[model samples]
Target: MSRFASTLPIASRAIPNYTTSEAGNPFVDGWYADPDTEIYNGLYWVFPTSSYSYDKQLYLDAFSSPDLVHWTKYPNILTTADISWAVKAVWAPAPISRNGKYYLYFGANDIREDGNMEGGIGVAVSDKPEGPYVDAIGSPLIGEYHNGAQPIDQDVFIDDDGQAYIYYGGHSRANVAKLNEDMISIGTFDDGTQFKEITPENYVEGSQMIKRHGIYYFMWSEGTWTGPDYSVSYAMSDSPTGPFNRLAKILQQDSAVAKGSGHHGVIHIPDTDIWYIVYHRRPLSETDGDHRVLAYDRMYFNDDGTIAPVKMLVKDNFADGQMYSWKTYDGQWTVEDERLTVAETAEAKAMLDTDFADLVFEATASIDYGLGDAGLVFRATNLSTSCDEFQGYYAAITSSDRVVLEKINGGKRTTLGEVDNMIELKTEHLIRVTATGYDIKVFVDDLTYSKISVTERSYSHGATGVGARNTAAKFGHVSVQRP
Candidate 1:
C-alpha cells in the first residue's frame, strides 16, 4: 500500500510559448519533459528535447517552475553547436550537481535518417543550474571506454562512498561505467575494464539508477518511445553500480487512455520522503502520431521493494487549488460541470476573463459554425478588435480544431504554424488552438481536420480569459491556477 494520501483537483496548464521551440518534423511534434528533475536555486528544473532533428543536432532545453504550475523557460543550456561531435542531436539529459558544479549526461546522434540512431553519450558541466554549460572535454565520454554499437540516454548515480557511475544506451543495450573523482573521465574497474554491460537482456534503455532503503534500483523505458508499446520496467541490486536483478513492471499501458507509457525519472521529496515518478505518455491525439505529454504519479514501494503501477485519471493528489490540471480537453469552452459553452457576445466573454492568466482545472469548448467563427481566447491585449482584424494579443482556439497562433503586428493578424490536430478539441468542431511558439496552432476537430499554425500579433501580457464568435453558445468552468 502507498504511504501518501491521494488528492484530487491539482491544477495543470501548458507551458507558454517562447519557453519551447517547435520542431519542423512531426515525429518530435512537441516538447518532451525529462523524467528526471533537479533542484537548484530553490526551483525545480526540467530538461527536455527542444525539437527533433539529426542526432547530435538536437539540443537540450530547460524549464523552471516554482510550484510546478506556471513554468518559465530558461535559455538553452546545452546545444550541439557548442561541441564538434555533437553536431546532430542532444537529447534525454539527466543532470546531477556535486561539489558546486553541475553535470549533465545526455545522448547525441550522428545520423539524420528517421528511426536510425547512430548516437553516443556525452557530458557537459556548468556552474549554475540554468547554464551556458560546456562539455567537459568537448567529446563523447563512451568513446574512451568500450567501442559499443551506440550508447546514449545516460543516467548518473553517486554511491554512499562518493563514487559516481553512469548507465547509458538504447537500441543495442544499456551499459555502465564508473567516473573518476572529477566526474568527467571514466574510471578503471577491478577487472581493469572501464565499462561493462549491466543487463544481459536487450529489453531496456533510458535507465535511471536510484538508492532507497539500502537497495539500489534500476528502472528503464521499454519498447519504442513513438510506438504503442512504450512502458517502464525495473530491476534491483545491492550495489549502486549494479549487476541488478530483474523486478516487476512499475508502469505500463493498462488502459486505452494511457498507451506508450515509458521514459521515467524518480525523485524523492525532501523531508516527507515521498517518491514521485516523472514520465511521458502518448495522448489521445497520438492516434495521428507520437506527440507526447508530461505526467507524474505518486510512487510506492512494497516491503519486498516492488513498485505498484500508476493509475490513469484526470485528477490526483498533486492537483492544487492554484494550478490547472486536466487529463484531456474536448476544445469547447467548458466549466467545472464539463459542459460546452460559446462566446457570441462581450458579456459571455467577460465570464472567462480572470485577473490571472492561470487555469486551475481543465475543460473544453466547441463551436458548430464553420467559416468566420472564433473559439476560446486567453490573455488578449484587447478583445474589442474587429473579428477579422483583432489584435492586442491572445491565444485562441478556432473552429478548424487547429490552434491559431495569432499575433497583432501593426494592428494586423500574423500566423505561425497550423499544428494539425495535435489536440482533439471537438467532435466535428471547426477548430481548436493551443499556445505554442509565441503563437498558437489551429486544427479542425474532425477526423479529417489537419494541423495549422498562427502567429500572435503582440503579447496580451496579462490575465487568463476566453473568447468566441458572434454566433450563439454556452461556456463555464473558469478554471483558475493560484500560487
Candidate 2:
C-alpha cells in the first residue's frame, strides 16, 4: 500500500499556513524564467527572463528583497529600447557589481546562426543595481556560435581571485570564457584561446558555476524546457574550466507542486555557507508556453558533497494584498480581511495558480446568503467563467445545508456523492478534500468519517481552486498539502 493509504478516514494534520512574513514558492508574481540571483548593497536581487513570446520579451525586470520573504519589483530595469541592436527576445540576464558599476549581461534575438545576425550575448552598464541600464557594448559581445554552442543563457561568476568568467550556451552544448576587466569583451587564455567548450554529461543549457570549500560546482539545465522533465543537474571539479564528471540531478518537477523546474541560478550568502537555488517553474494552473514563475528554495549539500533533492512549497495567505496567487476565471475576487472572498456572481471560479496531482486541501468556508453553493475544487483544468465548463472535481456546501461531490468535464457535470442538510447557511465550516490517484475523499465539519468518498480516474493532474455558483463566499485559513 502507498504510505498515504488509510483504511479509515481521519482529520488531516495541520498544514503550515503561510503569512506575509513567511517565504513561499514562486515568491514573485508574473511569468518569469532563467532567474539570476545576487546580493548587492546588502540586499538580495533577482533578475529573470520576461517569460512571454519572443516577440513580446523585449524588456527585463528585477526584484529586490531585504529578506527573502518580501520582494519589491523594479519594472523594466533593462529593455531593447536601451540596446538599439537588440530587437527582441532579451533574456537570461547575469548582473554583477564591480568598481562601483553594475554590469548586466544578457542574450537577445535568439540568434540561431553565425552569419550577420545581430543577436547573441551583450552587456549593459548601470551605476545602480536597479536601473535604466545602457548598452556597454553597441554590439553582441559573443555574437556567434562557439564550440557548437548557441550564445545564450550567460552566467557570470567572479572567483575569489577577482577574475570574472562567463559560462553560457544552449542546443545541448556549453562553453566557458574569461571576461576582460572591461566586463564587455572576452579575455583570451594563456594559450590564446578566447572560448573553451566545457559541456558536461547530460548538459543542455543554462550554465552556472560556484565554488565552495575549494571545489567548483558546475550546474546546468537538462531536458526540454517546455516539458515537465526540465531539471537542473550538476558536476563538480577542482578547476573552474573543468572536465566535469556528471554527479546527479538536484532540482526537478514535483507533480504535486509544479513542473518545468529548471534554468536556475545559485545564491551563496556572504560570510556564510548558506545557499539558495532560484529558478522558474510552470504552474499546473496555466497552460501557456510562457507561464513560468520565479521561485527559490534552500539548497543543502551532504557531507559527501552531493546535493540533496530540493523540496517544493506553495502557499498563499492573502496577506500581501495582491492576488498574484490565483487566476480568477469569473468574479470579483479580492484579498481582504486575511481571506479570499468572491462577490456574488452567477458562476465564478478562481484557481490557485499552482499545479498538483495528489494533494490534501483544507479551508474554512462560509456563505453569506444565497441558494447557490460554495466549496473547494481540485484536479481542475480548462476552466471557464461559464457554469460547469471545467474538468475537475469539487465538493461544496450548499446554502440548503447539503454537501455535494461532483466531477466536471467538457462542460458536463457528474454527481459523485452527496450528503443532505449537513451544514448551516452563513456559518463557518471546515471543508477538507483529499485526492490520491483515483481515490478521493471529502469531509465536512466532521473528519472522523468522510462525508463523501469515491474512486474515479478521469483526470490525474491539474490545479486546485475555490468556486462559488450564485453565492458570495469567504474562504479563510486555507491550506493545501502534498500527502
Candidate 3:
C-alpha cells in the first residue's frame, strides 16, 4: 500500500429525503452511458460518457444534485479538445478526491496510438468537483493489453485502508491494478505483479468494487453490448484483489420498457446502508447502440450481506409537472398536448400522484361550460367525504362570481373566507395554492384569496388535485415544485 493509503476520509453530509419512488431512477438529463456515481462536497455527481460514436464520444459530462430530485448538468467537463494527445472515444470516467483536488480517471482511444490497437486509460485533474478539468498527464496511463484484458471501462475503488485500485476490461476479460499517490499512473503491490487478472466466468466489461461491513463486493457488465443480453452481474471476495466467486445477476434488460442495460457503477451513501446502482440503458424503440440514456435505481442488501436484485423504474421529469410522480386522484382527467382536460363531469377532483409534504401547485384553467363552480383541491388523501365532495381544503370560484376558500370534510362544507364578485365566472384564471404544514394560502389569477390556519390535522401529506364541481374545465401548464 502507498503511504497515504490508510485513512480516506468519509464526509458527513445532511441526509435529504431521497426515499421517494423517484429515487429508484436515473434522474440525469440527456444521453449518457457507463456511469460512475460519487458524492462529493455534499452533492451527488454522475460522470458518464457522452453516448455516441467514438468521434462524438470524445467528452464526458458531469451531473450534480443537492438532493436526488433536482439535478444540474455541467456539460463537457473534460473533452478531447483539452487532452492534446487524445484522439477518440473518451469513455467511463471514475472520479475520486485527493488532497482537496478532484481526479477523473478515464479511458480514451479505444485503440492505442501505436499500431498495437490496444487502448489505454488516462487521468485528468480539476480543483472543483464539477470541473473544467485538464489532463493531468498528456498521455495514456496504460496503453497496452495486459493478461488479455482490454483497457476500457475503468472504475476506481478506494479501500478501507485508503488504497486506490483500478479495475477495467472488455473482450470477456477483467483486470485490476494499484494506483500510486500521484494517481496518474499505476503502481504495483509488494509481490511485483503490475496487472492482476480477476476475470470470472461470463465476464465482459464495466468493473467496479465497494467494501461494505468488511465484505468485498465486485460487480461488472456481461453479454453483448448491442443486444438486450447486455446486463450487470457481480462477484464477492474477502480481498480487494480477488479470486472472486461469480454471484447473481443484478441489472438486466426489462424487455417491456428498455434494453441493453449495462456498464454500471455503485454509490453507497456515506456512513449509511443506502446504495444506488448507476448505469445506462438503450431506450425503448431505439435500435442504435449509442442511443442510450443514463439511469439509476436504489440497491439493497439481504441479512447475509448479499445484494438484492434491482427494482428499477423509469425516470419522471417535472417539466410538464404531469410526468412521473404526479397522479390524478379523481375526475375524468387526461393529459393531451401537455394540457390537462377535465371532462364535463358532474363533480370530482384531479390531483397529482405524489404525496407532497410542502409544495406550490398552480395551473391556468378555464371553466368552459360556464354553468358551475371550479376549484383547487389540496392536502387531500380521500377523494370523497360524501359521494360528491372531497375531504381536504378547497379553493374555488363560484358560478355566482365569488371567490371562496373552504374545508370539505364529513359531508359538510365550511367556508373559512369568501370575497364576493372577486372573479368572473367561466373565465380563465390562474389558480395557485401553497401548503406548508397547517397553514394554507389560496390565490386566484395571482390575487390572494384566503390565508387560513387549518385546524384539521388528519391529513399531513397527500395529493393536490384540480377541482371541478359542476363545470367542464381545461387546465394548462400544471406545475408543481418544492417551495
What tens-digit string does per-residue lDDT give for candidate 1 at 7-49? 2222232321211111101112254644567766555566765
**Model 2 TM-score, all chains together:** 0.80
Clashing pairs in 3: 26-296, 326-353, 327-352, 327-353, 350-465, 350-466, 351-464, 351-465
TM-score for each model: 0.61, 0.80, 0.66
Off by over 4 Å in 3: 1-26, 112-114, 117-119, 314-483
Per-model CA lDDT versus the true structure: 0.56, 0.84, 0.73
Ranking by lDDT: 2, 3, 1
TM-score of 1: 0.61
- lDDT for model 2: 0.84
Provide the lowest-lDDT 10-residue window in model 3.
1-10
> Which prediction has the highest lDDT against the true structure?
2
lDDT of 3: 0.73
Candidate 3 clash figure, as a count: 8
* Tens digits of per-residue lDDT for model 2, 309-393: 8877656655445556677888898977767889999888887765678888888888988779999988887766664667888
Task: Please give the ranking of all candidate structures by TM-score, highest first, separated by commas.
Answer: 2, 3, 1
Error of 2 at 131 (Å): 1.1
